[model samples]
Target chain A: MNAAYVNVSTPHADRNISGIRLAHNRLKVAVFVFLLAFLVTAARTVELGVRSGAVEQSLALDIVVEPVQYGRADILDRNGEILATSLPSTLLQADRFKVQDPVVAARQLVEILPHLSYEKIHSQLVGKKGYVELARQLTPNQKWAINALGNPAFEFLEDEERIYPHGRLASHVLGFVDVDGKGRRGIEGFLDYRLSQTDQTQDAIRLSLDIRVQYALTYELRAAMNAFQAKGAAGLVMDVNTGEVLAMVSLPDFDPAEIKSTVEGARFNRAAQGVYELGSTFKTFTLANALDQGTIDLTDSFDATKPLRVGRFSIRDDHPKNRILTVPEIYTYSSNIGSAQIALEIGKERQQEFLGSLGLLERPSIELTAVGVPQLPPTWGKAATMTVAYGHGIAVSPLQLSTGIAAMVNGGRLVPATLIHNSEGWQEGKRVIKPSTSRKIRQLMRMVVTKGTGRYANAVGYRVGGKTGTANISVVGGYDRKAKISSFVGVFPMDDPQYVVFALLDQPKGTKKTFGFSGGGWVAAPVVKSVIARTAPLLGVAPKKEDASLYETVSLMIEE
Target chain B: MRRMVTGLAVITAMASGAAVLQLKLAVQDKTDNVRKIVQDIQVDERAIRLLEAELAYQTSPNRLQEQSNRFLALMAPKASQVLADPSSIPERPAGARVDSSIDLTVALEPEVKKPTKKRLYKRKGAQL
Candidate 1:
């Protein structure tokens, strides 16, 4: 019956019968072969799919890898100076296995990269790590030289390199990055997560630091440090208007580019980390605190005939007088006795509260990962109050002092210092004292700078006003008499206070101009003077040709 | 004649199927070549950029100054003879008065006289 059906074709019944038997056997074989192949393929695919989550994740990761390399962002200063940027740099790699002779390859590599270590690179190339990163950053010339070698396995990842063009200018504030390009200090450390990602590259890291002002301050301070043969130095410039840090420097500063070789001393950010017993400068705070508490008036007289005897310590000025000086005179001369009397009037509780109000008892509000806890007296008693009144017993960072001074003098408003520049009118300043009190403090500070210890800090057209502080360095074995920190804190155009500048020298050995005295007037005041003079023009604050009306009260207070 | 028609149909279908498979493979090959070419072009463009930058750097005024500083170790210029050419300063005022005391001519001081190779270069010491 099957033969007859196959033969139903008109070709030939006999031929069809033979062909049908052969076709049936071939059809069964073909069906069985296709089924077997399909089953094998399905089973193999299922096994591989179930085995590795790592493999699955890698496949997914490949899809999103472009954004990581192409989309890093920019860093701008407060006034739009390009502080940091992700510039395109070349990478150099080698085919170690293809290298016929390791010695010859290493020699050639060293010829191009003069500083490259052969042993280190050779090991990295031959290491178990699949992808070896030989040199992440390559100079344009170096890349050209490398490509000339022409090996197929030498892969270059056209990656983004973080470049700081300013070069060791604001090392402490700018901080540094690791091999993987991460910020380690200052604003870099503070805004690490923001800076590391690809999307945030378009948005800049706006810092309060003005490069022009920073250059001026650091340059002058460094020169002063060298001239005076000082052990160390630190300085800060803050906007009394917004508590913005225009410049902050702590020497010796290490280069942020090659951060690996930095010394411990160079790494310490003296402006925010090293606390000092701020000498007569504290009198500004003491007097302000007393005024704020209504404990004493500006014209009120204090007994300064002799140094005040408190336990074993005596509150005596560097230049004492046997007279009942008026409150202004006491602060102008920085008389410790008068400061103590004013502190006593305010009482320990009120004094403590006032200092605390100024934020002197806390760490400075700065964008730094590292800082020092202000060493406050355990018991804020009568002696503690008296000592603190003159800036002796307690210790605080330069940054804290700068901000505190700004708060006291800038219309009594305390604007917390930030590394990031705030938009116009964005800072809602906290008013710590009355405007009148602030004006009064400004006048008093001006008096100190013009007629008192900070005589050297007077910048002619700038109408500079400030106070000088020479604190004895507190050491483990009593206080280091030889080692003293001389510092000057200044405010320009005190009539309408705009900036607070602080200059300090660590263990300054007196210079020829100083006439062999390392006091604040000799060492630190001149630094402030030179810095303010240089920075004023760069900061867009032209030499004060016309005195603004806002400084009328301050001018009136100090004119006499 | 019927068997011949059946054989012709099978051969035509197989040939057409093979041609489709080959077209797909050819398209895939073209795409891969294009991708490789793109990557190569990127590498070449980067190389070109690096070379351009290097050329600019080698001829930079700063580089000239550095080279001058290096070679001048052998023959130091006289202090009084040094004069900073006012024209060299880009944004400086036309009547810019430079104090005579400044040793600006200690290094490369291109003069008003141009297009001459009267090389006033300081000879360098023995190579390190």
Candidate 2:
């Protein structure tokens, strides 16, 4: 407010103003730097928080949702029964560095596990600088006992033990696994990669086999085997409509758990793997072919009064009706001469083609590793054709025979056999013959059961129809007459066929109860009868009341 | 404006750091818990698998057949024994009372406790 304060353009005042301006700019710069630092710090904190949180979340998810890994998946029956599984076990190890006293530990370990040699364990415990595996596949009880010893040096590593709970019941089907958990035979060998795969969660593989039906088949076959003193036996039951195998039994089967110690012969799967001359069962195929090709009618006659000689072969009937036999009578009485004459009429080409269409010449298209290839004759000439007509000179597995019969009787459809359960039911197969021809085949088969060699297979109220076959086992030079293969293949509820049951006995000897007769009619037919009687109710097939009129025309044809 | 902005940035940084620390600790604790729970689940699953295997072994058809032979004496129902149609079963006698609690099945059971033939003969002789 005074004259001196109002002085302008003075040097001192100018200096003071300049210095204040400089200081003010410096203060602004400082504040800006601090703000930038704070912003950078905040951004870094947010980035770190997000990144760490993401990593932790993924870690948690990985641990929480990861699927458990069992060494192998289970094999189940259609009803969800466990046939084979893997049990948890451990491998015993010794940390050599941590072990204070190797001798004492080895002695104690051997005491707990007698199977482990004390010298091997002692050497291993003292041999290495690191860990040493002393034993593999220790049971839980052994692991617990080892833990009780309270030695920090002892380590129980995780392992798995494969077990078959059914023992020898389905040995041929499930097969046995090796010590390293690899499938070695049967279905297990066929589906090895599928069963042991670990990419995703694995579920049990269900088969088409009904365990109850399997038991019934095995029981009856075993009883017959024992009663008739058979050297080997094989049997199977199949769904005629879908071609699904319900049960398969091969006698002298080894337990899958103790497979290493069993005899090699017992390990052979006879039902699906052994090619034998299946005898007169092939007559059904011959007659069915003749009917399908319009070569012969039901009323046509074949001269079966004497042995039919073709080339070097003399074909005769086992149950001979020495007269001119009708088409149905040839099949009913299992006349080899009639079958050969019919085959001659059909010729070699047509007979071979017909059997091929029925899936008899090729190996069975089943899910088994041991499927036997059919041993066909070298040349389809006259003698070969005649013998092949009666199921000689060409050997085939029982499974192939059953399949051929199924096609003949199951409305002429040739469905390939399968062991896997089809959730979608009743797949249609390729038609092989006319439905009329199939009907005639069924009628003839029923006649066999009612009035011919298959009379023993007539289960009460079931109306079983079947054919009998008794073939002498073929040797290096010729057939061994003493060693015969007696077989019977039956279809039940002949009015509407549902299942095909087959039984075969290799070299069965006579018994007192069988009237010293080891023929298919005496030994194998009764087995089929028992199997049908037991399995009909389990299959939910009701017992149908007998309708006599259904067979009246056939009875007239036979009686006339 | 600069001072206010600085104050806000500092507060955000401190708050984010504190929150990150808390989150990390909680995650660490939860991870341990998850691992333990996963281990427990694995143990339970293994036990369940073992028990299922055991049950299957115990109830195998062969074992069951042996058990039936030894103690149960039960037999599979025959085809004739299975009547598919309910109408095929005979009706109760005429004038029979409709008593829901009266178990008619008891009368159908075989007389297991019936006297032996020798005892019956002795009783008849005594009566005579």
Candidate 3:
């Protein structure tokens, strides 16, 4: 060992010796630092974990678990008929990670759910980070099929699902929810959060729609539309006192159950989204305004011998048995000249205010999102007043017009329309006109039905009173005389004025019986009359001859 | 033996204390969870109320009966069946009029005599 190779004076040894020492020193330092870091880490770990036992203890006490509860709510109609409600439901989910051959599992799932996309399901199971996979909503049979798999991965989230037993009936009104369970439209849209929410547990949504009345309205409207060869139609009935919308329909309405489908013209809610000149129906407001404003008395006579002329336009009546007409006679005859005269007397400002007060000057808002903006007279001048008096210069959503009419003849009290069955809450009061004005309007409307354009709408013992309107379509260029918008607004039990029913036809073709005339009286009146006859009983309004005087007023007026 | 017994007792006490702490934490977590649940339930209830109201609003009958001649299958009540309260039906006077006077003779007068004369003379340059 003493005689080992020694480089006492070699340049390589002299220079390389320091390098070796330095390298060795660095290596030693590295080892010391490593040991020091390891010891410190171990100490801290002991201090915080094993010795203190703090984290472990804290983990055991974390609290954030969901609890289950029971009980639900009740639904009823305006007359207390249940429209939609909730019952118990079972939701199925699969733990994909626990599943053996996801492909095989998917195939089995397909056997149970024919609607399921087997490939899509297989892909999800094969490539998923989450443990569970939602197979599909299960019926009892589908649940059984999954149970046959006997996989522990399968689990059910006990829940409740909203159900509308009446399929396709008032579907648009009731609306629907998504698979994740969210309401999309109708009453469901209005009360989405409330119905979807859980207290300690379950809840329900109640509506004020009577399915019976809805069916009646839809059925009769469909018939009339078919009979009249109408391109499109809309109808509605409202409860006057409460402003409760009783029946509403738009031809080509969509089914709420299949809310995704764009079938025919069903997507449009005609009653709320469509606007048109309601022809002679405007006469109802004209007569009422005249009476309410003290512009004309019921006995006042108007010389309707010649068409009234105003600024390059001449007013014309649909039925041309021209003669001098009394105030009541003008109403019973549906004399446009008389209505225009009355509007002139009422003054432009008063007329504008009356229409504005009726909610006809703006887009309608009654909880639902579907609505149409009204086309009103920009300048409330004499011409606008005269024209608007007959529902020509202005157009409004059917709902706005219905609510307006409801407030008008129903004693001038405007009630906010509601679909929800109010659960004993504060009621709203908005008075639009005097009660005597409403009564006179009712009498005039009765006169119109008994002898004038609305005669077709007379419903026997229902004492139906109404007015008809026929207007030349005002198109982009000007007015299309060939295309007519015929409409009728009517009141049932005219002796007392219970409900206001309004119907309109968009470009109805003239029938042989109409003498090839597409006027409101010939085209839209029969529809209104039939509806009154049918829906009067279902609405719990027993028809009776309550007012012999009502008939007498119209009868005497017509005879003169 | 006594020392061994005492050590065993201390270990047992410590383990029991750990369990007690775990249980306390669980209870606290449960309370917080319950409070959160109540909040969620309140939200859900609100949604339910909205849905209830919205459904009715969308399905309201007056909404259906709004349009002119809106057809319905309902029959006019028989004379013996009129309701005692006729005011129950909603009516609006603002935009409605019962008497609308139109002189049909005026619109027809312009066309009635002109169409026949125009048809009677179809000559190449028929002057007045």
- lDDT by residue (A241-338, candidate 1, tens digit) is 87788888999998777788888789898988899998888888888877876888876788889878988877777877678888888878888898
Question: Where does candidate 2 stray beyond 4 Å?
Answer: A1-63, A94-107, A117-134, A150-154, B1-36, B90-94, B100-128
**Candidate DockQ scores, in order:** 0.05, 0.42, 0.12
CAPRI classification of candidate 1: incorrect
Between prediction 1 and prediction 2, the one with superior TM-score is 2
The sequence of per-residue lDDT tens digits that candidate 3 reaches over residues A1-560 is 32332546578766667777898999999989987986897687567655556666785545443433433343455665456655456777777767788878888878878878898778877776566556544677778878888877678777666566555666667667766667666766666666555671243445556676677677667766787787777877777667767777788676564666758777677788777766566777777777887888877887788888888888876665578778887777777787788899998888878777877877767767577788877787787788887778788777887788777777888887776666563345588779988887877777777667676777777778777878888888568988888877787777666788878787888878778887887777787777777767677667665566655654676654
Top DockQ: which candidate number? 2
C-alpha positional error of residue A166 in candidate 1 after TM-score superposition, expressed in Å: 0.3
| TM (chain A) per model | 0.83, 0.86, 0.78
lDDT of 2: 0.86
Looking at model 3 chain A, which ten-residue stretch has the lowest summed lDDT? A65-74
The reply for model 3, stretches above 4 Å from the true place, is A1-74, A90-103, A122-135, A150-160, A200-205, A422-428, A513-517, A551-554, B1-128
Please write out the lDDT profile of model 2 over residues A1-560, one tens digit for every residue: 33554476588877866887799999999989987996798787577667765665554646744556787888888788888888878888888999999889999999999988999988888895598988877877988999999999998888888888778887887788987889988888888888888862268889988887888888889989988889999999999988889899999889988877988699799999999999999899999999999998888888889998776657778888889988888888888998988899999989989988888888777888888999998887889999998899899998898888888888999888888998886868989999988988888999999999999999887889999999998899888978899999999888898999999998999888877888898899999998888889888778877787877776677743
Model 2 per-residue lDDT at A130 = 93
Better-scoring candidate (TM-score), 2 or 3: 2
